[model samples]
Target: MRLNSLYSELQWLPRAPEDFAARLKAAIGSSETDVGRALQRLANYALDLNRLSKLASAIDKAKSGGRSLQPLQPFRLAVLSNSTIDMIVPAMVATAARHGIALEVIQPSYDQVAQEALAPDSRVNSSQPDAVLFALDYRALPLKLSPGDAEAASATVEGGIAYLQTLRDNIKSNTHALCVFQNFVPPAEALFGSLDRAVKGTLRSLIGEINRRLADFVTESGDVLLDVNALAETVGLAEWHDTQLWNLAKFPFAVEFIPLYADHVARTLAAVRGKSRKVLILDLDNTIWGGIIGDDGLEGIQIAQGDPVGEAHLSLQRFALELRQRGVVLAVSSKNDEGIAREPFQKHPEMLLKLDHIAVFQANWEDKATNIRAIAEELSLGLDAMVLVDDNPAERGLVRELLPQVAVPELPDDPSWYARTLAAAGYFEAVTIAQEDLKRAGYYQDNARRASLRSSAGGVEAYLASLEMTITFQPFDATGRSRIVQLINKSNQYNLTTRRYTEPQVIAAETDPEVFTLQVRLADTFGDSGMISAIICRLSQPGEWEIDTWLMSCRVLGRRVEHMVLREILEHARANGIRRLTGTYLPTERNALVKDHYAKLGFVKTGEDDSGASRWELRVEDAWPAAAPMKVVSHGFARPKETLSV
Candidate 1:
């Protein structure tokens, strides 16, 4: 059968598990990219245990044959697992592979996690992976102490936390690998059962304390801790753990649920690679609410506690509200009269989401693809960062066909399943939630206000000046290291070198005397755009410096932020008696916006390499041009007392 035919069949083969397996195998055999797409399509279908098992086998087959599942950007992952992870490896690799992560997971010898992770000459440390997975379990913890022995239990908790911290410190100080640790899942048997929390020294309580300590550790260290406990609770304790498998292979979770667990890992790892979806565009009718607001009217619509159908929509609205709080920009793309669409948000008493909650509300008769594009333009984000959440398959298909860059999730047929379906999708996974994330909705709202102000100001320069923006440049410190690494990994459009660096790498660069590393934060009359840009340049010679990484957040684009960053670099170069500043434009599929970045900044092109990379340089002997329009301030570095031209 044709590849498209197989893809089409695998999407909705409800009754034919055998046929689904056969079709999936054929799809994988045909082409790697197409098969990846096919696997994504199949993710929408509710796969039975038999089908999932067969799919796992097919994934192993495809992986062993050298098919590149993650064609975009691959992550070098090493799992320093304490348990028998051999059974989980295939599904883990397959699930991650489906998500565009070339996940080559190296399973260190079972129970040898410390040796592999801490020792410099050990295989895992020697490989120097981009990220290391510390697949930990309850086995890492000691046996429960006496019920009243609170001191001993506390010591055990502290001991475990210290062990994790020491190992992480060793790895981090020695290598640039991100430590992805797994939070402990409480063992099934507890001394006090459900009442374990009533006493402090209980085993369950100790595990809980350990988990809490792990969270605190990650918060302080900027490491990643996966919440396997939450995953187990969501999947159900009865279904999550298999006694037979655990006894035989030390697998913490059931084999069938390994795929789901793998998906969780993949999403977390993908977030580290800058693959989280930023904007969530929701369709109004039957998606966020049960009935069409235009025809059903605000009161008549099904989005309240009294009706079952309405409650489903209410649950979905609640989920969306949480996402908004986490920095996901909520938007609306609906085929309805604009005035009528605003009624539900305005008048519905049971509506959890108010008008102010939505950053972009495009409720009109226009095509959804067009509306989505407008939303992207307004937010100054790429289509790839936007996710379309519509209940209608036709509408989803239209956006998927037209704006293939927008992620359109496969919605379940039943409206009641919408909330659960979207919850499980994990499209908005984030590695770190900075203070700036909590204020993102306000930032987007401020953007809208800026747009209105710009239209009235009559000129770009005048509008920018009217905002009275001030940008502060500070050296990367311990507190801001996580956000800096995030910007380095995620910022694409305005990036020059498109270089991604881990926290350790960034920390190393900060102390290097020959390197200048800075974090840029912007504020205006409207609000603060936190840590919007980063610059890393190394002294190439006695009189010259080379730009290693230059990137700015898309939210602060078109605001002359780049100009300010360049000016700061130039000032530092001039202050240190440097003669020339050199930079390169390394082309990438997403960073075309920066192709002429040097030219725009007055850096003349010196040469072009065989790989299409262009070299640019500027002689610092001449007076620099006028400073950037915004008020620029410097911190953590020496500034020239005299005026320096940019």
Candidate 2:
């Protein structure tokens, strides 16, 4: 965000240290097998191209030396564009380091978007990249100004999407790669003053129509869409486009904006790979409002309307509330008396954020680093899944040094820009939002109520019985496909194999005769937690079914949801004449929580691999005993005739 052209819209990653050159050298010379976190810490700084280029060089050296970037998942990306894409690849590779992705790029020849996608033997297809980015601009697209003919303008718009659709379809069919298409950025040159927006046949109108339609295409196809038009508009259209540079070097935009562009693209990649942050930890005192409630008292604080200083803080509250509504869990990390912190949220009439919006609230004199870790533990989330926003530089620096995994964005001095700066950070970039997602914060809050009930109940059986939980089981269907794919990628800590599946692959499993899929939802007396668990089992042999994926939301971890899920699995297996169920536990940095998952469910260990992946098997002859106390509702597949007795 420090770059003058793209300020106020991207993350204010920390500035480089005075000894950054030496640090970069040391990182490159590191003998450790994996230098991912070390390099990621460096890339999380506010770096210009010169520094980014040096980091890129160091990354290349590390790769050449046969080192690993373990924490960063390896991603093979193919970029198809009409402009000078070669110059942009290095920055992308370097910036992707910050997003926990080790990017392996395959760049076909410049302006080969059509040829590379269509040709069977093309390098783009042969690369078999995980994703294909169609980085086309307006000029590269089929758009023309008819100057007054609406039908001609409509034809141009229709033709533009058809062109992109053909390329997208061909690339996907050939490589099975998820298509990432960027909408066109129209030039600053408007044909008529202000009329360009309303009049058909104008270049502005034609480009707008295409971009709008293109967005719908990506949504329907379950692919990714990068709104370059919105990014350019935020940066100022005049500053975003460099006509002279395009004529000189065939550059799509100014070279200076490459770092910002790369950051956006890398974030999209991270979101697709399920690395997006989930929690927003906010500081209360001068951060959310004009004054501290602990000292200023309730009436002394400035948070109401008609006041300039007060409205600024209100803006941040409004923004945080909006993020919470979209599944970004909210937490409060404050150094104040607990009662004082609660007073503002409870008593302040103008506060947009109530106590209900927050999933965790840490109010104490302890250091923020400790409180942040506590919040993570309570939420059952990772430190890397959080972003801490504080008004005080000291608190920010303390968190940056102590909890390096927690993203500490640089805050501007002006309180008015707090919301805008956080908005620009894009730490919670999402490709899709589900109904379950919208109520995620409420789910965590409901978990707290369950905890309270458990504390007073004094026994596990009593607590379980008091909650009155019910779980519904249904086969994978079109209505639940989006949430299903999301939970598959996002539920890392509870996943057994940690395998990723694209939309098309999940669709294939829906009606596959040999495949079995289950989508489970849980509801208690307190509230309904949407789609808390999912399982996929594949036919391994005539009488054996292998559990390809078994994952659950940790919100229901201690509630015996696992036992209930296994019960449902047994019912389906028995109905299908499956005698054995095979389960695999592939170890990862985050999934150790589930290392003993299968073992706890009475699975016998069968095999172990060098990477710590262990396989287990369960033999089923008849109905398996249900271990949990909750009632289950199952609508079994018609072929096997599965049923659950109340």
Candidate 3:
């Protein structure tokens, strides 16, 4: 049960393979269990260890290649501890070192120090460490008797919580730091049952309150929260259980749980500490089925309420739902009739995966590789963040060969193992769930709407106007900070400046006099695009402005919204005494679509780089006419009522 011990055993599996198996066998004990079963379990463990090693290697390779492996940087962790700091602090430090992260242990001795630590004016002591790892059990918070005293205690707890928020808020918003809350380790009921139920109840209540407040603050602030309770529970209490003889035992919890816990912490840190994958490509037919509904008919397909295979498919759908819930964009690429293949999703009673769940679905006779490319285009997601899941090896092979960037999992033939394998692959680990994560699918669906409108409408302008497209431009606010940072980090296509700003960077930009940061929200008859786009621009001097950054949510592309945004920025620049507007087109693997954007916008190129990046400028008099009559919405300022002649 001790994760440390588990890690030790796993570590031995590679160095002393025979000794590792022997120890495992001794642990299992001779109960007439077959060698095959034991060997199978050992093999599975070995495979998991190998996967972890590969992941570590990948991290090293990325770092060595200067790929910006964000998780490896020094992380600032706030360790809140009252007692047992000796036991927990070392364990945390060991875990942090294993992942190449620095831990900042915050142990306040008095209420004054606690207050000082949590004060808004208090700077994150760089001497202490980059991120915070909060290690305090709930008992650290003050508890008192008088109603007034209780109020004071409550205020202190709230203040402490706010201090954590302020530290998170003021720090570089884009810095990959996590505030992990470790829930109170429940005391053994056998030892403490008769001690004092009231005390226990109070402690429990305090812990619950801390969890509630911390969860809300972390989620709202877009900071990462490590569900230590969930993780500990997953590993099981028996493995991590508090033992009376822990101080005496050299090997705690069988020496295997140490590495296991370390591994979990490392993986969690890696997941939360790094960038999130952007796209999920799924296969249809047997992958989502027991039989092809296209050829077998809806009734003939294997899905049913009672069948095991059908139940397995349903379970997979539930799994997919969980991924969608976490903001990973889902796409379907199947070799079947577009209509016939979608029948199950539409009509099947057992089906939990709805049509709306998918953002880009390609149901056609085309090869999966071709279908995947089309899906990527439709979703505007780079091929790199994509994970293609298909049951058929042939289709997987095609995708793997043609779309090398796409992650294709080698699925087992058995239907029962499908869900488990996908879960183990860890493709959907979300480090920090942003508001945009929840609405990503809806945004993609909005893109589908725009596409449908364009196809149905007689002309491009008609489709544009029919979208009822209103671009709401607002200066960067707290609510929109995460989206802006996300765009700065992930956006490639249509990005002018390509300046990757962290959350802290964005916050700092707010204080600059020349910087103009705007978040664009688009909505039509479809639901709110929910802050789907962003623009960051700055003025260098009088009569001159540079487009530092401009990007629309991939979901909003191809609708001429980019043009509308460009025109708006130009209009604003003109009003601010800017006679010439300058912009840069940075070349990236996926941003070729915007290579000629400046030229298209009527800017004459003054210089060009070997990488195809061009420097272009346009005078106010010669700029493209702002005649694209799109409705406008501005927050913090109103658009001019009188149309100014461009």
The candidate maximizing TM-score is 2
User: Model 3, residue 93: what's the lDDT?
Assistant: 38
Report the Cα lDDT for residue 445, model 1.
Answer: 86
Give all TM-scores, in the order shown: 0.89, 0.96, 0.70
- 432-489 in candidate 3: lDDT tens per residue? 5568788776677777766776788988777766766666777788777776777776
Q: Candidate 2 lDDT, tens digit per residue, 1-646?
A: 3444335234477778878889998877665754878898899987777787888888877877778877877888999999997768988888999898888889998899999999878999988998999999888887878968999999999999999999988898788688899998889988897999999989889988898999999999899999888888888888889999999989999877888888889999989888899999999988898888888999988898999989999999999999998989999999999988998899888988898888999999999999999999999998999999899999999999999889988987878888888888789999887899898888888888888888899899878888888888899998889899888878889999988876777888997999999999999899999898889999998999999999999999888899888888887788788999999999998899999999888899999999999999998863365667787787756744333333
As for lDDT, the candidate ahead, 1 or 3, is 1
What is the full ranking by TM-score, best candidate first? 2, 1, 3
The full ranking of all candidates by lDDT, starting with the best, is: 2, 1, 3
lDDT of 1: 0.78
Evaluated at residue 63, the lDDT of candidate 2 is 77
Off by over 4 Å in 2: 1-11, 31-34, 639-646
Tens-digit lDDT string for candidate 1 (1-646): 2322212122222223347766786767667566655554454344544555566566656667877553345677888777788767766655564455656677778789788767888878877888888888877656456566788888888888888887787777667898998887766666666778767778778788889988888877778879888887765666666878889878777776665677788889888877788898889889889888888887778988979998988988999999999888999999999999998898888999888988899998899999999999888788878988888888887887788667777766777767766767778898888788888877898888888888899988888888888888888887688789888888888899988888778888989999988898999999898889999989998999999999988777788887778777877888788889899999876788888988888889999988679999988876365565677767777652333222
Tell me which of candidates 2 and 3 scores higher on TM-score. Answer: 2
Pairs of residues clashing in candidate 2: none
List the global CA lDDT of all models.
Answer: 0.78, 0.87, 0.60
TM-score for predicted model 1 compared with the true structure: 0.89
TM-score for candidate 2, residues paired by index: 0.96
| Cα RMSD, each candidate | 4.8, 2.0, 9.3
Which residue pairs collide in model 1, if any?
Answer: 624-645, 624-646, 625-646
